[model samples]
Target: MTIATDKITYSFAEYLELEETAAYKNEYQDGEIVPMTGGTTDHNKIALNFAAYLKFALKGRKYNIFIGDVKLWIAQYRQATYPDVMLIEGEPIYYETGKTTVTNP
Candidate 1:
């Protein structure tokens, strides 16, 4: 059997099951799966800097800060994406990698 379609399609759950041990980063939008290009040195540095600042500012608080490689799920977009920085407060969602499941910041 062969599948036919004029559009790229994938469910959020199926997207999650893709083999990705190496952070083969990707982003999804409107039923399309787009590979994520690795960030440049400056991009990474900026992300790190922002995460650091959030960490310091939120010390002893319930919230935790994170940087790149962390997946942020936007259900409204039906997609999971990487954000430069994220802050999670209260009961946090955990993923297989021991990071928050989804965040926005």
Candidate 2:
């Protein structure tokens, strides 16, 4: 059987509220809240390896590496997602006043 999609749409504000106390992480796409599943071994391995390699290679540099749990905000598209690996130069641009979400990567 094919996967079912959520028909109900949720507002950004509502999503933020639910995410505050939700047990699992969910990605916000436009007006849809898509729940995330656990990562596979290969996925986790690659992401972790890349972040670790970059962390030492770029040490003493302005670039910072972030993996999992950190949400990236795409304002124009109204999407909030967790990238496997994110490399930011200088200070991260946060979304609003929250540290969990970032605008610039």
Candidate 3:
């Protein structure tokens, strides 16, 4: 489905095509493409610190920790956005063939 706007509308596939070449990230909300804001220093620090702690705690366990940059697809909300951090107990389930977006946390 394409997003309806005064200027332009883009389908999910089209959004993916644009996203591939975008300098920054864009989130898919319902049908709109929302550009993501850059993270502040404090935000980065907090994300990194939490990820590090989780990694250490889950060392030698069957788990994976992902920080910012990993997209999470929330189908129920028809949205896909990057999360601060993700803790997957096992292999990640992707939203599509690509490894960037994940369907399950």
| Candidate 2 C-alpha lDDT tens digits along 17-101 | 8999999999999999999999999999999999999999999999979999899988899999999999999999987888988
Lowest lDDT 10-residue stretch of candidate 3: 7-16
> In candidate 3, what are the lDDT values of residues 1-105, reduced to their tens digit?
998769566677777788889999999887889999999999999999999999999999999899988888888988888899999989899877998888888
lDDT of 1 by residue, 11-91 (tens): 766676662553677787756778888789998888888888888888888886767767877777677788788787865
Summing lDDT over every window of 10 consecutive residues in candidate 2, give the lowest-scoring window.
Answer: 5-14
| TM-score of every prediction relative to native | 0.76, 0.87, 0.87
Off by over 4 Å in 2: 1-6
- C-alpha lDDT of residue 5 in model 3: 67
Q: What is the C-alpha local distance difference test score of each model?
A: 0.72, 0.92, 0.88
